[model samples]
Target: MEKRVAIIGAGTSGLLACKYTLEKGFNPIVFEAEEGVGGLWRHTIEFTKLQTTISTYQFSDFSWHSFAKEESPNSQQMLHYLNSYAQHFSLFPYIKFNSKVMEVEYVGESSEEMEIWELWGGNGRPFFSKGTWHIAVQDTKNFSRESLIKLVQQQTWRPNLNRRMMALRCKSTRRHLETGVHQREVYEAEFVILCIGKYSGVPNIPLFPPGQGPEVFKGKVLHSMNYSALDNKIAAELIKDKRVTVIGSQKSAIDIATECAHANGVKYPCTMIQRSAHWFFPELNILGIDIEYFYANRFAELLVHKPGESFLLSLVATLLSPLRWGLAKVAESYLRWRLPMKKYGLVPSYSILQGISSCRIGVLAENFYDKLKEGSILIKKSQSFGFCKEGLLINGEAKPLETDIVILATGYKGDEKLQSIFKSHVFQKYIIGSKSSSVPLYRQIIHPRIPQLAIIGYAESLSNLYSSEMRCQWLAHFLDGNIELPTITEMEKDVKVWDDNMKLHAGEYYWKSCIANCGIWYNDQLCKDIGCNHRRKKGLFAELFEPYGPKDYVGLSHKR
Candidate 1:
């Protein structure tokens, strides 16, 4: 029998996983919760565009130049491109739309029954055949009807009662039904891959003291997820004749504020309350040069400290620290010259390199400063805020700002979302460690403690699509027996080394799984593990100086 691989998602990562698994002669079943593909791209606002250039974000085997000429494609164009790719590869037949995975349980010998060993998974058994996974899936199309049936069957239903009467009492019966009860089918797979994107799914709202939450506000309170779900027409009408305040200072906050400005247009300005400042570029160019020319190369990576570097290389990085500082100062000066960051008090205290390393940098929407100058958008800096009777209560203010709507542009809790999918409490504990600790994964793909499971798209880079593609390819190679993982002790030690390097560069945001500056280094490690040449370029000089993008890693799987 062929090996069966269950992939949970139909997003960029999941599509890549399915394609590569097929190339390796494995049967892949893709489960998607939505009716369609294109995970986060399907839900973003109309004006949202790709964060990175098209060339850098495309799949290694496919070129975006074949589709369009735009440097950065909008959300709809991206979704269309993804659909085209899926169709081109004939992946639709393997995908199950509107299918949600509820729980995953392992069916094998428990850890308590096995002898202790230093290696991960187990001691004497092949890793792939050590256990099988049972995944519970719900068909979302009939979810409502199935839920009603389940409720009636669980509580206050008699054998002699008419089906219509039983259905009528479902509302009250739902309240008494046990938590997490749903009509689901079990699927058995030898391997499972989770490709859920990190930036969506669960919203991370701030905790508030008693009486200071959204309940105290008379106006409408909406998370960014809710706002993104609305149609473009409805979203425009939401803040048309009302005072709107957006709380956050990231990409989502900027996009939502821009939309609000377009809707209200200076009659009622959109107020943006910022708790912290981050570096944002007006464009990807710095003084008529692409930003990649400076950072996305082998030589640039040598200036920063990397995980598990030799002593000689560490010394070289320390000596090159001043050059790195010079590069950051140059970029900072350019930003100040192009934008009114200093005048609006929006300049970040940290260096630009630090922002990029932590993945806190974003691109500004066109004419964003013009909106600010025309009073269509207002900026306020505050460390804390809470809900009041009328609107928001900003820190150090006696009175609240009267507004009709409050949009929380806070980000998602990706770690918690990943932890909630496992049915085993032991596996959940293994997915996430202490609150301050980063997720422990060898190569940012496989957890040493979790067997027969691999996770993609959790770790981020400058271009998530490219990053996830590389991870999926590496995972395919591993499952095909072309690569081998180190022992658990060694893997844990390597994870700690990477964590320390992240803390050194990212400072407070070390917990985030970002490899923005060290992307080439990470890809090089993947290539070495797959038994391919790490050097993708022809000559030593070009290899060191030329910018590496998705094109450089083409045919990596075939090479092995």
Candidate 2:
């Protein structure tokens, strides 16, 4: 039998990993906790549409227009597109839906002898030998070690001969229903890949002081994850004729606020509580061209280098700060004329380029300005939130907000989510250490201390799909023994270079693990590693002015 490879998650990255793994003659087994394949896209209700343009959100092998009727497909349409793509590639057979990975551990030494293993908690899965192995099922509380060992003994009964195995602690429904026991397996593999995207593992909720929980609040409190999963009827009933408050200043907050305002034909308007002012894009189109074309495409991308800084471009942008600020004033003026931003005190404090470079663009929803004008959505700028006797308190105000619903659209806590999978010690010492830091994977794919493991989709870009595909290409070549990795010391140095550069360009506290603001820099490095020319178009004018998007980089790995 072909050597097995365990792939966690059936998101876009995992699907691509499966395809490339087959191309490399490896047997890929995909484990997905969700019943479907679209990941977060699969969980979206009817109203959700992708923030980016279809061109920027698509895969190289698949075109959105080929299947989707709209230029920007809705979440359901995206789910359909993913299903179509899976059918086209026949990847459905390799997927094991509703299977959650509980733990993974290495087992066995060279070839001489086998040893006994014990169960422990809140620490690394104790490894008795040096062999690669992964194993078990359900959440951490539901795991059974005796059953796990029995299953392992039954599978590897033969005399050991340099065995390399990865015990995958997984939970599947079939075993629970048939045998009234959990399903667990130890996979012997030459390699293992983790493609779990940054989203969808855990919801990032704000920490309240001791004794202040949701139970203290009279209103219905929920994270945006649960809100997005709500059906139309329940969603409408939850906010009907009630004062709703949405917390956050990003895409999800804007979306939820708009949705609540529109719920039941504007019966329950929502108050937006923002911690800080953010530069929001009122429209994707600016001056008759898409905003991405001007900022995210090729010519604009060339201006920045590693660490996302530019000597010439930085000087020009800084020297011409007045021009950049003036251009922003024009857009702000136009928006103020159309919307009641000045009345609601919704003016931004940062420049347009500041938001664009940081990947903080928030597309204005349809009729959003109209909702604000009609008193359906209100803005209350605040520095923080506090609890009151009857309701919630916004900073700089004494009056308590009597709300019927509070929606927290803060975002995901990625580090906590990613670290929750592995044992606590390994995650702390190897991945994060005591002091919190960005992911330390070299090239945002492989770690120095972790052997035979690769993580994809951790390094986000302007276009996650496109960047993930490129990563999969590089990983496939590497796994097939076509591409080689540097030494451990060199790899650590490379990670330091990336981390240092990211802080320099993106600033501290930005999502440094992701390449959100440095798509070109990250993609260019990947292309070079795969022997592909990074440039999409030739000529001096094209190099300096023309916009470059996914169309220019498709199938680039095969070019050389």
Candidate 3:
């Protein structure tokens, strides 16, 4: 129990690690670079009212504790919830804020059964408390994997920490112990649970003409996250007098465009240059079904159909976004439901939340395009590469639409921090397992070379919270020696399979993932084979995760 475990971030997953580690009787030491807890969710998420769409998104047991002022919680609301969870569970005692774990080392092989962790941080701020949110989860029922999925969903709000792993060197500072891998002040431990997160750092911002980009915008062209009060006020004024265009197909682009169209109304002639058409929906989505009753009885039938096949089978039935969006355009033009329609399928772009409750988005992703099209809204299409002094340029045609402010809803770059790791040969060669295993680690969870050292937030694929909590449980099991690791050969094989699968279904960018939710992306099956009991158990936690439990989620929304 004296084995010291180090967690790098004081964010959602970091706090969860503190909780699980304590329950399992492991000494957890969390080092958060931020002055406070709640990593990106508390720091730099672009939109404040972020909400998720994953039906099984929240922790299995914790109820919706916060009354998110509006229909959904804003950034402040989320931070408040996280702070409360940290305080109520008494997690402060275990954390060292303002202190960063500069580096980590494998050291030498150990004769003893346990692996050693050389842990050291700044002689900075004092830890507020001794235990950072320690709570136990016990799910002793259920038959389906979905059941087990429900049990783990209880812990919402996990961050994507894959790219940030580079901070190990990128933001390197010297004080206590430092080295390439063999750091100083080596604190050996039987187990090391890495809770460093992944998402905030992995932004895939599509680059355009460099200097002519935001730098060219006469007014403002800020990244979405940094967009704040001043931008909004200026937007309000511009809407009363000018023309606005929001670029990008990602969520951020949709949000800014939606906000502008609604606000500017008749005054500001808005243009939304979508490279392709997208299906619009309410805050809660329902792929193929009608908006009104889909959330009622009809959609529930779909959610309860039982696993399609290996959890992957659902892919065949669910259909991809490309196929889905095409069908929606067809339906909207021809189909007419008997139900009363009040601007159906159009919510704010901020309402595009499909994340688990544990790691929910800080903003609301609704459908504003449809709303604006209805006359009360004013939006058109004009995709532009960058801006020219007169106004913004669309395609090669220099279309000058002028007067006032600009909100660049451009996103962020989470992987920039880990630019070093990506450049390393070791990373390119052995990057397999998707188990948080980039650093000689397997499946992004445990390092085969360094047996006892483990990390939780790196299963960059479909499911986020599910994989994160599962990794935490598995780390506990492996460190406790209740389970065994794949043989280096077996580990290698698993890596190869994961590499191939990601290449096939995902893409090359997936080689370095940021999907901290779904464990299925890589070695989900491996975790299952090893009998990480939590993943296989049908415990009480699963009941709350049913996407159907919430209204509008039945085929009405992408509840599953």
Ranking by TM-score: 1, 2, 3
Candidate 1, residues 1-560: lDDT per residue as tens digits? 23668899999999999899888877678878766778888789977888888878898877787676888788988998899889888787777776677778887858674335466567411244557788777656555645633532211111211112222111111111123755676777777899887776678898876788999999899888778877788888888878999999999999999889988889999999998788888878789888887888888899989998889878988999899999989999999998999888889888898898888888887778888999999999988888889988888988988899999998888998899889888888988977777788889998877778899998888889998998988998888887777887788888888877888899876669888878999998999988888899999999999988988887685454
In order, the Cα lDDT scores of the candidates are 0.81, 0.65, 0.44
Error of 2 at 426 (Å): 2.3
Span of ten consecutive residues with least summed lDDT in model 2: 115-124
In terms of TM-score, the best-performing candidate is: 1
Model 1 — TM-score against the truth? 0.92
The segments of candidate 2 whose C-alpha lies over 4 angstroms from its true place after superposition are 108-130, 139-188, 307-342, 433-436, 538-540, 557-560
The TM-score values for the models, in the order shown, are 0.92, 0.81, 0.60
TM-score of 3: 0.60
Per-prediction RMSD in angstroms? 6.7, 8.5, 13.1
Sort all candidates by lDDT, best to worst.
1, 2, 3
Collision count for each candidate, in order: 0, 15, 98
What's the lDDT for residue 310 in model 3?
48
For residues 1-34, what per-residue lDDT tens digits would candidate 3 score against the true structure? 2345666677767876776667666656666644
Model 1 spans > 4 angstroms off: 113-115, 123-127, 144-182, 558-560
